[model samples]
Target: MIRKLALITPWPDQRTGIADYAFDLAHGLADVGIELDVFTTCTKPSRTISGVRIQDIDKFPGTFAFDQTVYQMGNCSTFHGEQLPVLFENPGIVHLHDPALHHLIAFFLYRDDTQDYYRVLRAWYGARVAERVQTFNELNNQGFWDSPHVTEVPFFDPVLEHATGCIVHSAYAQQAVHSRVPNLHIRQVRQAYRNMQPPAKYNDGEVLQLGAFGMVQQHKHVDVIIEAVKRCNAEGKRVHLHVAGALESVCKDLPDLAKSLGIENDITFHGRLSEEEFLYWMNNVDICVSLRFPTMGETSAVVSRALQLGLPTIVNNVGWYAELPSCVTKLPTEHDEMLKQLVAQLQRVSTNGEQLAQWRAQCRRYAQTTGSFEQTIQDYVRTLACFRTSAMAA
Candidate 1:
């Protein structure tokens, strides 16, 4: 019964992972004969899909006339701030990209008013969390925004208050949303990726090539990966790491850390790569060390990309990463155990050529079977149709 669809997300040229995801989903939806109006915060979208009409979200009408409206909600305030008001006025199916929206709400909703922020926290998270926030504010007044209070807590109740239904990409995210807002309609859809064929053969060079992709932030555990690579070298295995992704101010210490560990030459930090450049490096790497810890209940697009490309990926045994298939190498949660696991993994993949080949094959098979773009398009259409039918009845 769904005819026309309205999609709200950050468009390309914004340089965010969600932007890229929206771009691909828009194209896939258009290909399936769906009439689409893609709304974004960007005044001028740098790229466009052939049958999809891209427009600024400000132009969205006051009336809720579309068959269904889908709002892509993530943890970035700059990208998702404007969409919140529209969501409140006309509730829609919100694609919850990150379960923890503490930073986004803290930065965008209550940035100017300190007291109001605490009041809202108390209302959403109870008095205990509010007291903790007050103590945190007193101790770290200079750097409270990026502190653990903002990063760890899930202050997402306000944003999801008006959402008619929710789409989450991981089991962790689905559970987080349902547990917090028990009555909300929620669906779990694995993040999709293009089905790519694995490389015929990995690099046969002496130095093992490792890659760590996505935003190089503190949570990514890139520093630990660097030390792991150094340990691998010490164990008589030559290893080199290639990091490709957005390198913001928070990641400035990574290069210096590499130098301190005496693995400067073994690692290269390529900041903010273009799509072509990113794919090029991904295709060439032997294994991906995309470790994440203290996760915000977010899924990894880099891990998806690595899987489809038939490249083995290494992730910590936590959050959504733990739910990934056996193709990925899951390290321990403890720091010391993780370091030992990473070193052992790198060494094993380097020497045990047969096991490495089996892992690469497994990755391609799993990636093609589970999270294809075609499945994503179908899931969206089906979910929208069901919601439309429910709306008509209610």
Candidate 2:
């Protein structure tokens, strides 16, 4: 039985999705009587959040005097920068948020220190992978960070090689990791949804509102949602797009794209909304569109939040989103067909009050029945026990 644990992650103050997840998990663990000490990149002195002690990463004792040390690993450098070094030096159970970790590993190998690039590549992927690493280095030097080819190869072996065990949010991620590293102990845990008050019944007025939350990125296909809304408006359907979260640098031109599509006036960009504002728009929206392509095999906190709020969601039928219950609308895979389907679905839901109400009720039921934070905490506790047993045996 794991009694005390050290959790390494970006805390709530960082304003990243992983940070929010870490804090939530910490709170849940604390509630279950598990002692937890959180370590983050923030250089502030130790503080208490939700009954958990949070300290700076630099202040972390080189070796934790706890039953287990879990590091929350993600692809973003902002969240992983300080945690990565600790992960490599003192490996522990890794909670992999994104299965596609090529970009993060590439950053460490090439950008951080070129000297270890070839050596680390050979160690993880054998001599054959050195050529691929060289090509990656050259392309990275040429400023092609967004190239799909960068993540074509799974470079997560480096992290997995050092991990005592691993935890992934979705079965898809669990399968992906198992296929790559079959012998490793991996647990599939569902991401917990935030508790939300039952929203007041939506009044489908003249204008139908569509919402997209989380960091606006190319893979999220905010552009597609904007295009679908434009088409719906052209077909005599009054539709508007409300986007939450700050526009990422890669997708900064989304406002321009909306302007070019002639739907700028109909779209509202609520940049980095507060919790109150986020829930306000989420509860008010007619439908939530959460689409992603070239998925990292990670679950969406935004989509989970929408489901918890009983808002009908439209997701792309790919990766973990494909596993969503039938209550949520799923867009087809093909680009043209996806846009067409999205436009049709938006039109149908906007005009048909009965269909919209049915979807809302079904989604709420699904969330209420299957999305329990208490269950998620129990799952974590069980999974952590396995790691403890393995460590004891070793």
Candidate 3:
């Protein structure tokens, strides 16, 4: 029975994956007749949807008159930090895009004072962890953000304690949230993506082209993918890699790494791409390689988009990616064997036209049958409506 909603999220103009996702979801919700108020920090709206009203987040007034406020949250501090006060002050349905929120929480709490950060950490995680803040900081300096303590410990309680409900995209995320906040209402919805026209006839060319999308980070294993491409070429297989994402961020050295390996010519870094350019590369590549290690129970929008477009994708068999359909080429988690497996798979798919076609058909079937944007929108409506009913009954 929800007629209207307030969506607190970064809008498409921000050019982040979460922003694009929220944009798509807003349009879907609006199409289903739900009046939506989109609260964003952007000075002007990027795109318009009939039933969605774009309002400056500064004008949020700390509360909403709508039935529910869906807050799109992720791991990035820059994008999600300012919204913490609103989330803490107004209880709403939190659409958690990433289960591990240590960095975001740390950045916000420790921005002004280190002592305040430790005090809050101790209050939420206890003395054992607060005392080891120095160690965590040292390890963080060594780029161990995905280590056991950071990824396993749920740093969400401080921010999500007041949330009325939560929606997660993967089973891994669902389990993580349920373990931390058992009493909170939780719903698992398949990540949403609209099916695009399937890519032009599968490329049967001799040289295999691979693409890696989204924010390129160490966890995404773009370096490993580069190594795999080098090895495949060395073994008499022609392979090229296309990387498109933020290059100025954590993995700025990827181009340098590619150069060091003498495969700079084989790899192309497209930096951050527009939506049209993203889809263009997705269609052009022979295969999409999206590998993640030490995952924070996060699902990839890139993988979802690839599958919906019937593009064969390769995923590492861990965390949320493990739950993907068999149509995707999966690589084992062990680093030693991973390269060999990837090289072998790339060689096989690039050389065999029949196998590639089967994977495409199967992936398209899964996307068409398992879940579509239409179904995802319906799931959101049903889940939101049920939240009110369940609260009343309780």
Candidate 4:
């Protein structure tokens, strides 16, 4: 019997991370001949993407509008729109990127009377808004794996049990699902190695070029990178920092940041990048840096992209990043030593391409072993096969 699988990613393409995950996983599932339909929300007038059949989720009720998909395409409520359909249709498995906290919060804050966000809001202002916002706020505040509504809500169980199985990227994520309902036959997957080409790595004496992606979100620690670069430059080090992604809310602040550090010329803020521009910075960048300041240790798909390109990356010591790269220098406490390691890595990457090549090979090998398109598709297919067998028996 032919089995059908539905992967629900509740965000638009440009929102990226899980959305890119949904796309890549869909391709992987399709590579293994699994019948799958990708349901996710997109805002940029419905367009069909390569690999899987994309079902465009309506944006009439968009609450997460301050978004610009920096690394890749935009993503929205494809999962949310298709959630009920997934339940009734009963696909073999339904892989959630994570719980709907981002959606819930976006709906609470962005979904208010100011614009399209407010229309879908169940409560606004006074006690009702306070109560509704409080619930979502608590979810964010408390973090995942331990939430009141996780299992208290019945919808989770059917999705966990009867819906084939679940797939998550990290141990923390897997644990969160298990916490909602114990012993879920879940597959703990990591972020996939992207399909990209590496840039020519740079050296010690050459200008140390650093590329930082994502918006200037307060939580992302973009400022910390600037400060570190400034310190490096102050000590007669040639450092150039390039930032990609949207500057919607952060443009004014970005220039001021450089000016305040007196390194405005040292840093170039590329407002936002198209596919080509983004890749240019990514491929040419001497060091790909992502400073995630204690933000739940979630792994970055962007880092995966860099790995695919064979660009050496430097990320804050988060859950899997330490393990992701064979050669990684942890975020430095002392400015002098940190700069020394940073320069050393750049030299090794540039002069010692052979060593870097070995690490890159490891990256490719790991992707082939654990993250290949075939692995993704086959697992998804197997999950669906099980779901079909059980459903038909019922």
Candidate 5:
């Protein structure tokens, strides 16, 4: 039997990790003979990419672009209500992106169950003038407010009950789906991971280079990381920081931060890099620090990439990174606590050559064994195969 996959995500001119993952999945599926079509919110659909059929939604002469149409459906716009039926018309499996897509889906589930007679009567008598009232009534009606489909995903069991299967990035998400929707069938797979290859001489250096990977931002703890490095340098440690990435949105307080610290010369701002330059920077990085401060995610694609290239890393103990074996030091995001860990980790990595060597080896081993690109693709291949099974689709 021929199998087709209708992958829906934010694509075309894609930049994010998820976007790249979608591309990789589509490419891998094609390599194995699966028919794939991509519909995305990004650029107008192209007819083909790397041999897979890409439907340019622009050809539809529709109300909005593919992304905009689906975006509203997520927002619960009555206009967006049209896309769901169309999503079902595709002769393949539907792969949803993230949690934010639910806004529009909620309205459909509510209207499907427990009719609202009072609002119906009001709207029946008053058509054009009552548009606002109908929308409000539709949103406010308590009968459908907490419906299973609206409240939870696996709970919306029936909506996806027909879907071949669902793809999620992490074990945590898989557990969440199972715990919430035990009867639903799901295929667990790790999303693709990438890493930068740190040069072998990453540590055989005179100047200690600590990079913030982007402009100074609070979430990234750019300011705090700077302060910690300053403290370390004052304590006879020779460490400098190179802040890379495009400074598209400037942080408001970074100027005053440099002046107050009085170590402005110690830092080099690489502004923004073209795609080629950015990869070059990653390839040369001694340590890639991911500021997962204030929140935790399942994984960090950047961290994974650096590990692949044997780039030693110091990450905030957020996400699944706590499980990896490395010189990973978890510290409170507080300015004080961050300073202590930063200073200590820098001093150790600079002077303790043996320890730094071991940390680099750990990064290489962990990333190579678990996060190799081939392994990630294999996981998805097995997962999509399971979804393609006729029995599972039913």
Candidate 6:
């Protein structure tokens, strides 16, 4: 029933994950006959993408002309910097990409308006929560806030209070948000990747290539994969790790760690790749190792891309990744155990061609079914229609 709609998200030129996702979603929705006016924070002049109109966020009219407005929300400041205030002021359906908004909220408040931050925190979560946030900030000021643990109290409640409905990419996110706001309407949609032809199966006698994509950080456990690769090499298996993404500041030490571990020669860092270059690596890699601990309750677009390319992936058994099909290998939570298991998996995949082939087949089947672009777009349209109907009824 929803006809004209406003879609707010970062555009593809930003080169962020959500930017690419939003770009594709906009195109898909347009293909399905939805009228969309896409708004981005990018300062570039207005243009059109895939038949949908794109405009700067600052030009958004004080009131919407569409049936509803959709905000694609995330924690990263680079993309969400200008969208945060708009989200709070013009409440609408929110597609929350991450469960915790603490980082996003804190960045805006601490950098721009500290008083408003405190006032909003007190209003949303009460004085005790505000006090805890203040104490956390004090520790951060003293250079003592370096832990990898996620905040137990996510700061997304304020946004949820104003949302007409919510869309999350995973059940874990749905449950987490619902636990906090029991009556909120939350819909879980399968995250989508661009449709791709399945890469040709690797032939025998080629060196096994392992890939780790996206932002490299300590939590992503890129270093652990290096250690596992070292173990595989020590055992006489010829394997190489090809990392494709920007190295986060915290994980800049990864190259040094690899050199110290004597596996520097077996790894290649392809930082900030273009779309074609990324797809080239995807077509060539044998397997993908993407593990994370203390997940942000967000789905992995990289893993979804791997599946779409018919590549087997290994992820830690936590958060949204845990919900992936069994074809995607899940490692144990403990670091030491995860490394050992990864080594074992590498050995098995290298020695057992049949099992590897089966894994690739399973990935292809999953890509064709649950990860299809058509299905994702249909689900989104249905969800939006239902949300509109409910709003009208109320």
Q: Each model's RMSD to truth, in Å?
A: 2.5, 2.8, 2.6, 8.6, 8.9, 2.9
lDDT of 5: 0.54
Over 4 Å off in model 3, which ranges? 61-64, 132-134, 138-148, 195-197, 389-394
- Find the 10 residues in a row with the least total lDDT in model 4: 66-75
TM-scores, one per candidate = 0.92, 0.90, 0.92, 0.66, 0.68, 0.90
Instruction: Tell me how far the alpha carbon of residue 233 in candidate 3 is from the true structure, in angstroms, after superposition.
Output: 1.5
Q: Please provide, for model 1 over 1-394, each residue's C-alpha lDDT reduced to its tens digit, 9 standing for 90 to 100.
A: 6778899899888968899888878887888898899989987798898888888898887436688889999888899988888887777888989888887888864669988888898998889988887787788754345553454468888888877788888888888888888978888876766545567666667778999988888778788888988888877888999988767687788899889888899998888888888889998888888888777778888887787777888998888899888888899867889888888888887888787778777887786576567877888778767553122112
Q: Tell me the whole-model lDDT of each prediction, alpha carbons only.
A: 0.81, 0.80, 0.81, 0.53, 0.54, 0.81
Between candidates 2 and 3, the TM-score winner: 3
> In candidate 4, which residue ranges exceed 4 Å CA deviation?
1-3, 10-14, 43-52, 56-92, 99-164, 197-205, 248-252, 332-394
| Candidate 4 per-residue C-alpha lDDT over 8-36 given as tens digits, one digit per residue, 9 for 90 to 100 | 45433445556556656556655556555
| Top-TM-score candidate index | 1
Report residue 358 deviation for candidate 5 (angstroms). 1.7
5-76, model 2: which lDDT tens digit per residue? 899988765777888788778888998999889888865533356767887787778545778899998888
Candidate 1: regions farther than 4 A off: 140-152, 200-203, 388-394
Q: What is the lDDT of residue 174 in candidate 1?
A: 87
